[model samples]
Target: MTKDHYWPKALSKFWMDNEGKVCRLSSEGDLVRGAPAKFGVVGNHHYIDLEGPWSHSIESSFQAADDRISFVVDALNSLEAKPSNEEMAYMKRFKAGSFDSKSKNDFAESIASLIVRSPGFRHKLTLEQKAFRNEFLPDLPFRDSNDLKVLELRNIQIKYPEMIASLRASGKIIVMFSDSREFIFGEGFLQDIDGPNPLLPCKCFVPLTPGMAIAFVRPSGPYFSMPEVVTIQLTPNEVNLCNEITQIYSRRYIYFRSEQPVISKEFTDNVYYFLDYSKHPWMDGLLAAAVNFEDN
Candidate 1:
């Protein structure tokens, strides 16, 4: 089979190898081998692996995934995928069967780094609350991945319904994809709600906000980051009590989206992809807060 016939046919999947290193193996899409895409949507052109020294620059991975990175990120920016004309348009561009690999690869660094939710954000000048304020805002004008400004916040919110409701009732959620579990949405705010109750087992009232990096997505295709949460600050001992007591972290790889074509980081954040939100069971309110940002 030729490249055109096979790439659209296979679906890509990611998993961890025994060495604890992240490995991505495809179920199909090898041009030499004729295998069809098992999933409904056409293949993401799924190439781009971010690991090792190159994790800082996924140039090789983009070369490998055929640059599905640029396609998806581009499609996401101007067009909203709907079942009607919009969705069809997205697929047309996605499966256009030809790509300017050279140009796209030149722009690969935009989505090169995955924002992380590591312990560093809390104490360091990087990823700190003040850092977030200095760098990001409710509304960011368009900018390409090359000039992309992004921030990643970890352990953002809880999955429970009551918690989500409490967050929504508050306006202008203040989490900022930063360290505090503060939600300042429409009318009410989670920062005022008090973070997760340390007294309860398995209940993260103030769950650590997922590490989310909010960046500028240039029309030329540098993608931005997304996240949602209202964390309850806990002391190290309290954190240990919660860890010894309940499962708070969202299962990795099982519940997050990636830059694809490139593995950007080691862990997952708490936000849902905008492309996934409409159909996602309980994420409408959260999506609104994140997308509704405007320069004040």
Candidate 2:
């Protein structure tokens, strides 16, 4: 359409498909799968746009982090709160570059993405990402360019198997990875079978690499349907083991790719879980609208 061309009225926003690809709902009812949409879950809504089609798409949750320097600007303008001169200056630089031009990288190796992989993108950090790290972590060990340069460094995935093993390593338990899908965290990796029923037919444990875990479940129901997810606090050793596992597996994924645009920070978690059910950090339908990504 030209500048003065009449355009059809339609909704052009983001939504998730059966698989977790960020799809762009075009104005003409066309299903163009795999549009790159940056998402800020939790309580963050600082939209940081750069170049390319990526700049055109953004999704923020209701409870998005209030860390955008712009928020401060709005509040100050609206008489919400006051910042010192230094604070104002920092806010200027922060907004110009991003909420967090130089902040800690708080993602575990199991879930690390552009902030750790792509320098071009990491050079531009998001505001929500900044808040999450500052709130949860005091300092990040791997932020320097030289430290991130160690591309071979594999962040551990999980070390929970040992702890779980110590306490009933073979007990039947529901493994709720997220709010939408419910899979039993079976005791050992058994994903050779991708069943028709992802919620009810999964029978094996998820594969564990560094940062990932290899749990051994003692099946409660040989034919169990959807499982429940439990929150387990891991010990130092267990955490270390998970990272060890994640390191081995992170290598398998070298890029942040979707259907068409191939975005990042969306799929650094379990590759099997994503490929198995199209689950991305930002692609959950309900989550895309409500709640935020898990507190991992």
lDDT of each: 0.22, 0.23
Candidate 1: stretches off by over 4 Å: 1-210, 213-278
- lDDT string for model 1 (1-296, tens) is 11221111111221112332222222131111111222212121111223244323212332433345334334223222122222222212111111143423322222221111111211232234345555785365324322221212112212122223322222222121222222110100111122223221111111111222111111112222222112112223322222211111111221111112222122133222121211222123232433333323
lDDT of 2 by residue, 199-256 (tens): 2322222321111222212222233212211222233433333323222222112211
Off-target runs (Cα >4 Å) in candidate 2 are 1-193, 198-227, 252-296
List clash counts for every candidate, in order: 48, 38
Each model's TM-score, in the order given?
Answer: 0.18, 0.20
**Could you say which candidate leads in lDDT?**
2
- CA-only RMSD, every prediction: 23.0, 23.9
